[model samples]
Target: MNDVSYSLKVFKQIGLLKPVAPHRLLGAGLQLAKWGPGLPSGVNAAAKRFPKQTAIIDDAGEITWSELAGQVNQLTQALKERGVEPGDSIAVLSRNHRYMIVAIVAVMQAGGRVLMLNTMASRSQLGELARREDASLVIVDQEFLEVAQDVDRSLVVLGWADDDAPDDLPSVASLMAGQPTSAHAKPSRHGQIIIFTSGTTGLPKGARREEPKDLKPLIAFFGAIPYRGNSTVVIAAPLFHSWGLINFAFGLSTAPTYVLRRKFSPQQVLQDVERYRAEVLVVVPLMMQRMIDLDPAVVEKADVSSLRITASSGSALAGDLANRYMDLFTDSVYNFYGATETGWVTIASPTDLREAPGTAGRPPFRTTVKILDPDGREVPQGETGVIHVGNDMPFGGYTDGNTKSFAEGLMHSGDVGYFDEDGRLFVSGRDDDMIVSGGENVFPRELEDALIDHPDITDVVVTGVPDQTFGQVLAAYVVVRDGASLSEDDVKQYAKTHVARFAVPGRLMFLDELPRNPTGKVMKRELPDFE
Candidate 1:
C-alpha cells in the first residue's frame, strides 16, 4: 500500500481519526512536546485523556492511568535526586509487574539508559553483564535482591517488595511516598533501551535501540494486526524480550489496559482473559501450546470468547500447533517472524495461518524482506536462502561491537527460508542448522514438523548427532501425549512413511518433555546423549 493509504488505515485502527476534545488533544500534545514521545510522554497523555481508566492490573491489583502517571513522575524525580544523570546506564532485574513498568519509565524519563536483564539469568551472569554494561544503578524485585546485590550492593534499589519486605533497600513505593506527582523537568537527551538476545546458543548479546523518531514502526505493526485503541491486552510473554517490549510500546500509543503476572501460568492466563475481557493476548508459542494442552474441564470453565487477537512470537509457531489453538479458541492467531536485530519482518494473520500454515505472511508497510544467496545475489522463488530484512526500527548492532551480515541495505536474519508461489515466506530452519547426513542435506524443522503431525506426538525436536558412518546422523527426542504409548519402532515406521529415508532419525528417544528456554525455543544443547 502507498504511504497515504497506509497512514489512513493506521490512523483509523488506532482511533486517531475519531473526534477528540480539544483540551485533551492539547494536553497530550504538550506532554509529547516535553517528553519527545517516549513512555513518559505516553503515560502523561493517557492520564490527561483517561485519568480514571485502568492502566495496569498486576499482583497488587488494578491501577488507574492517573495513579500510574503519578508514580512514574515521582519515581523520575527520585531517581534524578539520587544522582542519576543523562545517559547513565541503569540495569533493571524484575518480572512483569507494575513496579517494573514504573521503574523503566522513570529511568527513561530521568534520562538514564535502561538495560533490561533476563530474570532467568544466573547471579554470576547478571553480575558480569551489569559490570560489562557499566550500569550505574540496579533496580530489582525482592525475589532477585541477592542477584542485584551481587552486581552491586551499593547501587541496589528495590522495584517491588512484599508487605513484610525488609526496609534496608529503598523501594519504589517508599521513594514515591509523599513525593510530588507533578511532571519533572525534561532532560536534554532521550534514553536508549538495551535488550539482550535469548542466549540459547551462547552468551546473550545486548541489542541497543532508541525510541523511533517517527510513527512508521507502529503504523507498520497496526497495519498488519487488527489492534485497536482502548482495548484490554494480557501480555503473557516476558517483557525483557523484544516481542513483549514492542507490545508495551504499542500500548503506549494505543492506550491498552495491560494485564501482567510475574510468572506464566496457563490457567491464570485464561482466568485473566475472562476476567478482564481482554481483546488481545500476547505470548510465545510455548505458552499457547500449554494453554491448549490444559485439561478439558479447566479449559471449559473459562469464557475466553472475548479474545479477538492472539499475538505470538519469540519462536517459530508450528502449523499443527496453530491449527489446534484456533480449533480450540477463536481463529485469532497472529504469528510474527523477526529477530532482535531486524525488528519485524513479516506477520501472519488469521487467514494467512489458515491458508498457508507455517508460512510467515507478507511484509507490512515500511519493511522489506529478501532472500539472498551466499554470493549476495537474490535467490529464485522457492529457493532456500538466507533471510534478510530492512526496517525503520533496526537495532544499533550488538554491544560487543559485532554486527549482523548485511547485503545491499538489508541485514541478515540468520535463518534460511523461501518464498512460495503465493508470495508467502516459509522459514526452513536456521542457516547454520542444516546438516549433511549420508551425502544428503537435511533440516531439523522439516522432520520436527512431520513428527508433530502425528496424533500421539505432543512435542518433538530433531538434531544432528555424531555417527561413524554418516559423519552425522539425525537424533529425535519426542514427547508423547498422556495416556498414549509409542515405541521407537513405531516412530521409525511413521518417519519412514512420511519423510525421506535419509531424513529419518538414526536414533530415537522418548521423554516426558523437551527442554526449552524461557522464550520457548528448544535448548538443543540440553538434549540428552543417546548411548
Candidate 2:
C-alpha cells in the first residue's frame, strides 16, 4: 500500500471513516456558509443558522447567537465611527469575559488585527506592546485598565467595565448602544491574530498568522477527538495562549455553546463541567494534575461521564499523569504534542499511552517529523536528536525578525527527542535546556521524572548551573506533597535508586511552588542560582 493508503487506514481505525447524515452536513453548512475572510463571518453564520441557541456562558450570564451577532454589529459600527481600518492593530487586555469576546469579533468586523495582551503581564510589558505594536485602540478590562496608563496617549482606549460601578472610563455597553446595528463589508485583507509566547526565559515574542486556509489540519485534529457543531466545550486554558485561542477559533467555526471561567480551580472546573454537561474539556497538563489531586470523594461526586474528549496540550503530559487520568477518566485523555511555532506534531490516545507509556504518539495526517543530530544526519530510532516538523498548519514566522533554525523543508522544534521502534515520539526536553555535566549529556526530564516517582514528591525541576569541578552540575528543586516530610538525603537516595550516578543531583532545595509562566511552563531562569 502507498502512504495515502496507510493514512486513510489509520483514519478509519480512529473512527473518522464513518458516514455523515444529510441533515448533519446541512447543519455544518448553515454554521459555515458565510465564513469568509474575517472571523466575524463565522459568528454571523452561527447566528443565521441557530439564532436562538446559546453562544457563550460566563459569570455575567448567557447570550444567544442572535444576541451576540447584534452586539458584534453594534461594536463594529462603533469601531467604524472611531475610524478602525484594515490592517490596524486593536490591542486587548482583559480576563475571560463576555465583552472581551465582543471586542475581538467587533474589531475584526471593523477590519482591524487583534493583539491579545497577556493579562498576567506587568504594567511595563503591557505598555511596551501597545506602543511597539502601534495600536490604534486599546480595549481594557477595568481590572487591567491601570496598566494602560503609560501607553501612547495617541492610541484610543476603550474600557469594558465590570458591574462594580465604576463612574470613570467609557464602558462597552455604552459604546455599543451609541451605534446602529448593520451589515459590514469585508476587509481588503483578512484580519490577522497575534498570540505571544510565555516568555519564561525572556521577553515574549508575538506570532502572527494569516486568516484560516486549510481544513486538513483541523480535520486531522477532529479525527483524533470528537469536536462537532453540537458539542459543548469548556475552555480552562487562558485566552492569550495558543491552546486557548485555537480552541476558541474552533468554537467560532463549530458554533458550540462554550463555558468560560475567570479563574480556574479543580473544584470550579469540575463544577462547570458537570453543570454544563460539557462534552469536551480543553486544558493544560497542570490543570489535570490539580484535578487528579482533588479528594477522591469530591471527584466521585462529579459526573464527568458527559466528556468524550479531555484534550491535554501546551506542555508535556508525563506518563504517570497520563495513566492516572486514563485510570480515572477511562480512555478519554488525548495528549497533543507541538510548539507554538510548529503547530501540532503528534497526538497520543489512551491506547497509545497504555502500549508505550510516555510516547507522544505518531504524526497526524499530512504532518511529518524527522529526528536529526547536530550535523543534520538522521539519527537511528531510539537515539535522541532534535525534533523537526512540517505540516499543513503553516507558521507565518514571528513579529520579531529572529527565526528558529530550519533544515530541509521542516521547521526546527528546538525539542530533543527520539522515535521508538513503533514510531512513537518521545520528547526529552528543549535542546537549549540539555545539560552537559562532567561531559555526559543529561536531559533534566529524565532525572525529574525519576524524582517525581517518589510518593512524597509532588513535583520536581532540575536545572544546571555552573560548577568548578564538574562544569555545570545538576541542582534539584522539589515541591513536597502535602502532609509529607522529605530531606535532601532522602531525595538523593531515592534518585540514586531510580537513576544513574551522574544523573543524581549534586544539591536539593525545596519550594512551596515552582515559578511558572501563564502556560504552566517552569521558569528555570527565575530559579535561584546555587553558584
Winner by TM-score: 1
TM-score of each: 0.97, 0.92
Worst 10 residues of 1 by lDDT: 145-154
Best by lDDT: 1
Q: Candidate 2 residues 1-531, lDDT tens each?
A: 565665565445433344555564465455354445346766786676667889888878899988988998998888877788888999987777678888988888776889987777778888788777878888877777668778664464555565773555566778898576666776676677887777778777888755656456655676665575556788888777878877777556566888887778889888988998888888998888889889999999998888877888887775478888767765677888987778888888878888887788889877889999898888999999999998877787788766668887888998999999899999998898888889899877888878866888888888877778888778899999999999999999988998888889987899999987666788777887674
lDDT of each: 0.88, 0.78
In angstroms, the error of model 2 at 501 is 1.9
Evaluate residue 246 in candidate 1 and report its C-alpha lDDT on the 0 to 100 scale: 86
Q: How many backbone clashes does candidate 1 have?
A: 0
Q: What value does the lDDT take at residue 24 in candidate 2?
A: 49
